[model samples]
Target: MEPLDWNKHYDLANLPKFDMTLCWNCKAPATKVCSGCKETRYCTSECQKAHWKKHKAHCKMFGQMHMMGELPKIMKKNEPKYKGPSMGRCSGCNVRFTPNYPPNDKCPECGYTACESCVVHEVRGTCHCTNHNFGRTYCIMEPRWYHKNGKTGEPYIGDRHPEDPLHEYTPDMYEPVERQCNNCKKITKVFKKEYWNPQRFNTSWF
Candidate 1:
């Protein structure tokens, strides 16, 4: 048996227990080697300048991590929340902003936040024995299809067996709406229901 490299196993750890190769100013990988005297490192143009004071004495020592001829493989946060526009300095006063979400990021928590459309597009999965993409869904609160009937033998419906519910709407939801975008162009849409009820009954009893 051998001691394992924690960095390799815990590279994505969120808590501050481990030190990541982050630019002193911003919490990003210091992958870009400094060109000035070729003895410093930073993640962006701004960090390069911000870290100069600290990195000046280390010119003869290790400067920064060279990009291994590869753009770091970043896992995209699906439907990442759009926290408006952000502009700020890093812990070392280096300014930068990412297009995704704000800077106070952790792995698992950040992975779940999403924007409106991506939040509503809906998702599904397949059974191991027979792969299928059943759209009609159910949840204890909303997903209407796959809910547990609470009857003798109904399985919990449209739940996470496939994936968490996305678009939430039961069958009887046919309706339309009109709106205008920032350009003032008219738009209309009908958020149709997921499943069509086959247990039809007469509507004339009113």
Candidate 2:
């Protein structure tokens, strides 16, 4: 049997220069190649100079990996190992379900997932999902939904889903506030629940 090429299975192993040819800086079609690595591409000299500060470490590491001839092995090693079952498990209830089962509610930020029942029960009316009993947990909701108010400079709820618990409340009246977690007694940022979108709830509850 022929030896398997692990590089074919790894994403990072396929550098953008070989595929898309996008400039590492401006993301434009790049023709000029990095003299040192010959792998990184740049659209212009200025873009290359500007990106050097950030790309320097990566270029150096790439050179080392290339010289060692272990890039494929390294890429394979770094590939994420998903420990979750093929049938997804709920982050809250830890229930396993078939692949065809209704989609689980997933955290936009961290990609944490929980079944519909556990999500509703744990989140309550607040837009926070309880994971571990840690101090001052981060809000799992999409951060873009919160924006700074013009006058106050405080973060306030922006556009809300149709079924949001506080959808009727305008952004001017209510501001995003901090609340203490009941289990850990730690101050955490909480928002009004957006029921329709990601938080799938039973229809009869309405």
Candidate 3:
């Protein structure tokens, strides 16, 4: 039987890049890229083998993106202007910090940190360690439909700072909260103020 493809199964989108040219296990200059995913690089086979346990999940994810023709898009590095704070790095993924969109997830062990896809429980849970918190600092709030201009009452559509104001939206509005699904009637933890759209519920709550 074939292994599960979570991207397809979960309708996942906006995958991350594994295209760094340095050794994934150590930050040495590398010439060898993982044959399996053609994304991660390693200085030697030893480094590849050493990193396999941790890289396994990311390797599989990148390989899946390749099979689905999504690899090119991820590897392109078309990042938008930085909208988040100047957090140095993510102790979890070791990548530079980026925006957490909204309802940012703060690492339980340390305060006000965000990680790659911190919104996901499985990913978020592994973000803290003995030495330091793997999550970065919360920088900005992503615009949401519920955020209305104070005077115009129109939906605000831009990155928001903590001090910024929209009469209808609060910084904590997207923080995870429990809500009852209108369609299934099952209570689930959702980003606060998020609406349920049955068709897109599996992928997002906008």
**Model 3: how far is 81 from its true place, Å?**
43
Ranking by lDDT: 2, 3, 1
Angstrom error of the Cα, residue 48, model 2: value is 0.2
**Candidate 3: tens digits of C-alpha lDDT, residues 14-103:** 443343767878878998988898777899999999988777877777676666686467656676633333356543344565454333
How many clashes in candidate 3? Answer: 1
Tens digits of lDDT, candidate 1, 97-132: 346634342112112222323223232111111111
lDDT for predicted candidate 1 compared with the true structure? 0.34
> What does the lDDT come to for candidate 2?
0.49
Per-candidate TM vs. native?
Answer: 0.19, 0.25, 0.27
Q: List the residue pairs that clash in candidate 2.
A: none
Best by lDDT: 2
Off by over 4 Å in 1: 1-21, 36-40, 63-206
Q: Judged by lDDT relative to the true structure, which candidate is superior, 1 or 2?
A: 2
Model 2, range 6-93, lDDT digits (tens) per residue? 3454455654344438887888899898877666789999999998877776676556556567668888899885433233776555
Clashes of 1: 10
- Counting clashing residue pairs in each candidate, in order, gives 10, 0, 1
